[model samples]
Target: MQPTKRFDAIIVGARCAGAAAAMLMARQGMRVLALERGAYGSDTLSTHALMRGAVLLLARWGVLQRLVEAGTPAIRRVTFHYGAEAIPVDLSPGDGVDALYAPRRALLDSALVDAAWEAGAEIRHHHTVTALRHDQTGRVAGVVALDEAGREHAIAADLVVGADGAGSAVARLAGANVQEEAGHAATCLFGYFRGLPDTGTHWHYAPGAGAGRIPTNAGRHVVFVSVPQARFKAELRGDRLAALRRMLREDFPDLAETLGDARPDGELLAFAGRKGFLRQAAGPGWALIGDAGYFKDPITAHGITDALRDAALLADVATEGTPAAFVRFATRRDDLSLPLFRVTDEIAGYAWTLEEAKALHLKLNGAMKREFAALTAEVVS
Candidate 1:
């Protein structure tokens, strides 16, 4: 059967990775198709903070200005609280980068999609990828997607990318192998609040739990709590809001005090810990990026950064469009991701005692320092 429509690439998931990939490839004069199951600009559960690496990529793609113009606040410092002590660290990503930014998912995802559209990529929201389509040679040829009208559509392409997320449909259909995995450690709960006060990005850690607060656009504060899943269940007895409030007051007293008259603006959302893993990112005509290929705990708030990095890296290979390009993309993705994954796993384990937590925190900071120094050396050389 001959397909009616064809593209250079078909990307499932139109959030950060897919949209960015489409934008980059389209800018390079490739015919790209991006599909998203959800409506455009919809919000999802995410840390929302963009690390230095992600910010740099956004700047390169010309989307950072759009985010800032939309009112995302700049986070210039980070304060870590371990028990009764507080340590403030300045966040400078070198090469004159002075601050980090956390924008609401709605704003950020839309910007990426807009960039892709402006670059001449075809985008279809409310389109779900039903399965991967393959040729007789066993290489992927395209995808089976269901459109908004509940009708099935066959879209052919030279390459198919699963930027769909941790539970990626394309990865599953392609049977991508998991090469490395870290076990689940904690449960995460978060909500947005109005009238809350913040001093940059703040983190608090105790024996069995950790919490953080950051200001986003519209002067809203995003607060989160991560605790051992078993302990969280036992303490809450299924009352999530009560458990969240108690976790704040008991484990993060200072952060709780700042709540004052702050009222929650949305329903409290909770997610159980899932092990993070690195999947075989590419095979034949298919490749994966974002949470689809590698996922780490949100404790480090590095998901968006990792996603943007891979999107850019994969886009480069896609531009080359060579037979071995996908394999090279997989190797490069692992080289950059494995170290941060291990570090984040250590921090996400909520079973650590106060002393162990402090030691681990120091180690994490040391790792970041070394990374920054290496970046500086590279730039200088």
Candidate 2:
């Protein structure tokens, strides 16, 4: 069936990466369509932490102030606890970014979708892409999606971008193979609590276990604990809240004390983790971004940041509208992502000692620094 309408690009997910890509591409005068399988402004499971690179990109795109106005707390310092020792790092202001934020996914994703809409990208929420449409040359040219009413629509575009996340239908249909996969994964359980004292961001680490507290919207702090996936399946069954409490009390007693009488505001959430992967980033006429293309363990809390960064990178090259440009986009993304990926995989293993974890964090920090530098250069040039 022939498409009734055509666009320069059709983005499969309109959350972070897809909306940002649509906004940037629309800003460059391309006709863009962004489709979301979920309702607009809906929330997803997330750590809700944004690193400096993400903050910088949001600022550059003129959306950071919206988050600030919406009451997301500014994170200026982060305390890393290795066993009994605590190391505090003050985020230095530079390149027009003073602080980072941890906005709820509902807010952040909505903000980006709003930005895309304002930039003239057509956003269709509640639309699920069912398959890719290829031209006579056998290159992807559009998508067949089902609307909320279960009506099917065929929409054509010059490019189809899969921002649909880890289990991306676009990746599957396009046969975007996994180029690399991590051997380790970690399971996490988290909940939000009100009345927890504001503590910028706190990361607690003990042998084979980790926990953290991040202040977010509505006077709430998201507190979480992570353990090896094997341990989570084998030992942390039955009462999940009890298991979380036990993990926090044993590995992060101070955070447990900080919780005090402040009970969780919502049901506890769990991420039954999967091994991270680097998928084939771009194909003939389809490209992948965000967790659709590259995913690392959430233990590092950098997924949102990586998504925003790649959105900018892909948008920059996508204007060229050539397969080779997409290749370059993939290459540049891998250059900045591989180190962080390796370090995050190791940390997710939960096989490191206190000293070893600290060293791994240092390596992670160095990789983040390089990513920041690359983004800075992109902004400059």
lDDT of 2 by residue, 48-74 (tens): 999989998999899999999999999
Candidate 2 local lDDT, residue 94: 96
lDDT of 2: 0.92
TM-score for each of the candidates:
0.94, 0.98
Candidate 1 positional error at 280, Å: 0.6
Model 1 lowest lDDT segment of ten: 372-381
**By TM-score, who's the top model here?**
2
Residue 375: error of model 1 in Å? 8.0
Model 1 ranges with Cα > 4 A deviation: 237-239, 365-381
Residue 256 alpha-carbon offset, candidate 2, angstroms: 1.1
lDDT of 1 by residue, 164-212 (tens): 9999999999999999998766778888887776579998898878898
